[model samples]
Target: MSNSNYVLVLFYSRHGSIAEMAKFIARGVNKVTKMDVKIRQVPDVSDTTTIASPAVPDEGAPYCTLEELANCSALAMGSPSYFGSMAAPLKHFIDQTSTLWLTGRLIDKPACGFTSASTMHGGQEQCLHSMMTPLLHHGMVWVGLPYKNKALISTTSGGTPYGASHLANSTNDTTLTEDEKALCEAQGQRIAEMALKLQ
Candidate 1:
């Protein structure tokens, strides 16, 4: 078990692709010393108001709670893009976090974001930007990989300074490129470093 403080890596992955991205980000978070990463995911959402998901996820990362968001030293939020924005499930989850905002539990913490999409131009950057909104509202510091990360310069598949991403093959679950993986690690390390400095 990790005894040191943690950077919570929270995400919602519908097609498994986003989940892979989350793992790569966590890999980056693991690179830091005396600080660990906790991977948590949200449960699925349904359009029918009467239909509800279970409290525990059947697979992938465990479902995240408001306390998870409130307690983490930092965060790396992810989601697959949907119409130039974050997916509804993640949006729904964030909508319920106003209490955290009110208490300013996230203030001054470093935060970052990531995303995946079926197509090369499927608004991945927009999705990343969309996830950044609530973090900004909470007064959390935003982080992204710098150009100094070699992958940012050579990646034709997926990877960006805005965070990290995967171009995503047709199935939308293609394995992340080496570049994408490196950038995810870079973002994690960056957030962890800042979180440590803030301590």
Candidate 2:
């Protein structure tokens, strides 16, 4: 298992905070020797008549494919909180994984979650939980941060043992604090390590 093995950092972002957090996590994944990361994103679903997004996004990571999701050694999912849950586009994409579930393609793989929310108390934990549910159902091992990270104990803003979290503020202008950045990197390292051992 070398850099040939990759962790899929999949996410959906509305205001860019979650996407920004994905970068630190990817940096952490890259810290481990023989490991690499692929960051992917889902498209916004349409409620109007059927319309497809561009083949490639205008910017950021390319859209995630089911093949990529099924084949990755590990997964790190991110989403912005939507009323205490994951945003609907990410959920809609996850719902399409029944075929992978039927074949057990993702079973026993390592998985972790990250989230961004509007306030300190704005359901980041719940958002993490919501992201975890599908991974659990897929039989993927859930990876979480540990309190030993120190930031978990001292953070005034977002940093959680549940995963990595960020407080984006009302205007969505808040940047990730140093504590949150460290935890994101730690989480990426942890998942890459687990994926290596599992391999």
Per-candidate Cα lDDT values, in order, are 0.85, 0.91
The positional error of residue 185 in candidate 2, measured at the CA in angstroms, is: 0.5
- Cα lDDT tens digits, model 2, 18-98, are 898999999999998878899999988887523257878999999999999998999999999898999888998999999
TM-score of each: 0.95, 0.95
| TM-score quality measure for candidate 1 | 0.95
Model 1: per-residue Cα lDDT over 1-199, one tens digit each: 6755899998888888788888877787788888888899887778953226788777878888898789899999998889889988888888889999999999999999988888889999998899888889999998988899888999998887788888877765668878888888788888888899998
Clashes of each: 0, 1
Off by over 4 Å in 1: 48-51
